[model samples]
Target: MSVTRTIPYLTIPSTSLKRGFYIGFDTDTLTTTNELGTQTIDAMAHQHHTSFLFNANELYVNEDPENGGRPPRVNENGRWVPPVYRDGFLPQAPGRMFRWNNGRIEYAGSNYQWFGGQGLTYPNNETLQHYSSTTLFWCNEFTQFQMMEADATTIDIATSDFPYNRWYPLTFRYERTLSRVSASVEEQYLAGRDGAWIAQLGLQAYRHRRNRPTEGLAGNLATIVALVAFSCTDDDTLYNVLINNLAWRGQLRVYDAEHGRRPERGVVSNIYLDPENPNGSTYDALRHLEWTDGPIIY
Candidate 1:
C-alpha cells in the first residue's frame, strides 16, 4: 500500500478585501517556522502602512512669503519704485527704497539692494581693482582666501589669507531625498550630515577580478554564482522586505571562501535539506521556483 501526503496553502488578504488583493503560498508539512510569525504579512498591506506618511516642507511653496513691502516712487516706466537697502542701512526718505547708480549697489529698496559688479577700467581715480568686505562684497575691498598646498596639513577656514598658496576650496558630501507631511522633518537626515543611509530596496552585489582589484565588474555575476553554488556556499545572501518604517521581515545568509557557491536552482528545498540538524550546515540541491501576485512576505 502507498500513502500520500498533503500540504496546506495560505491565502493572504489585503486590508481592503474589496480591492481584490491577495497572495498564495504552499507549506511543506503544515508546520510554520517561528521566523515567519503566526500571521504572515501581505505586500500590498505593507505598502499601504507606509504610503500615508510624507513631508511637505521640502518644496519651495511651503516657505513663508518675504516680509517688508515695496517702496514708493515713480520710475520712467510708470511703476512705484523702491529704495534698496545695503549692509544695514537704507537711503533717507519717507519710504524705505531709493535708486542709486553708485559703488557696488545699484538700486536700494526696502531691506535689499542689487549690484552689477562686472567689467570696469576705473577712472584714474580708483585705486584697487577688487574690493572685499567682512559682511558684504564691494568693488573696493579685498577678502582673502585660504588654499591647501601640501599633502598633509590642517587648514583653517576662518583665516582671510591662504595658509598654503596652492590649495583651493573643495567639498565632498552626500545628500538624499526625503518626504514629509509638514511635520517630522529634520535637517540632519535630509542633508545626510552624518553617515545616514537613504531608504532603498533590492539586492546589491560587488564583483571584481580574482587577480585584479583595480578594474572590477559588478551586478548579475554575484547573484548568478551564488544561486548556482548555493549548497557549497555558506548562507551569506541577505534578503529583506520593508513594510512601513520598520523592517517587518528579513533573511540573512553569509558566504566565505571556505564555503563556496552550491549548484542548485530552488531556494526552499535547499533550505530544508537537513531536518535533523535544522541549524547545522548542509549541502543540497535546488530546482526552480516562482512568485506571481506579490512579494514573498514572512
Candidate 2:
C-alpha cells in the first residue's frame, strides 16, 4: 500500500488599504524532510504600508509643436536636456504610471511648475481624487512529491503526482465614497498564450453604507467598504498541469450617482511555468493597488 502525507508550506499576509495605498512581496527559503529525504524551497509573503504621496495624480502637457511647442526638459538630477515632442498629448486621467528607476518598476508622476511672487517657482497641486481601490492577497509556493525504495537502494518519483498547477485563493476588498453605493466583483480566467477568456467565475455583489464611529454635530463620518473572497480550487478541472499560462483577472463595478453602473478598474495577475519543466517559473504576483481608473469627480 502507498501512504500519503500533507504538510503546511506557506502563509500570505492579510492586507488592508485606504484610497491611496501601497503593497509589496518578498521571498524566503525553507527546508523540510520526509521519507524521501530533505529539500529546500522558496516561499513568498506580502507586506503593506501607507503610500502618502507616492502614486499621486499624474500631469501631462500638450506636447504638439503646433500647440505652442513643448516645455523645457530636465533629468532627475535637474540637468537640462533637449525637449522631445509628441504628436498628441497623452491621456490625462486617473491611471497608473510606470517608470524604470534603479532596477525595479517605480511609480512616478510628471511635474508642472507654478510661478508665484518675484518670479519664484512653486510646485503645483496635481493630486487626483481616488474613486475606488482594490486589495488582493495570494501565495505561490514550491512543493515536492517523491517515492522512495524500502531498502534505500532504488527510488522513483513521478512528476504527474506533483501539484504543479495549484490554484491560489483570491481575496478582494473594494472601497468607494460620495454616497451609499452597491458593488460587484467578477473573476476571469485566461487560458493560453493567445490571452482568451476560457471561462468566467461567478460574481458576488453587496451594498454598503458609511457609518460614523464618533458622535458628531454633523452627520455620519464613516467610509463604505465591501469584501469578496473565493477559492479557485473549487474547480479542480480548471487547474492545468502541463501549461502554466493561467491568469486571474478581476473587475470591480460600482454604482455611481452620476454614471450608473461603471467599471472602477480591472487587475490581471497570473503564474507562468515551463510546461515541460516546472522548476523554471515566473510568478507574476500581486505587488500594489491603484485607483487609476474611474470617473473623476473633482
Q: Return the top candidate by TM-score.
A: 2
Model 2, runs deviating above 4 Å: 1-27, 41-57, 63-85, 90-283, 287-298
For candidate 1, what is the total of clashing residue pairs? 35
lDDT of 2 by residue, 81-118 (tens): 22223222233223222221211222233331211101
For each candidate, the alpha-carbon lDDT, in order, equals: 0.19, 0.21
Model 1 local distance difference test score? 0.19
TM-score, prediction 2: 0.18
lDDT of 1 by residue, 63-181 (tens): 11233322332336553221122111222111111111110111122232112221121233222222111110111111111112221112222332454322222111111211110
TM-scores of the models, in the given order?
Answer: 0.12, 0.18
lDDT (C-alpha) at residue 97 in model 1: 15
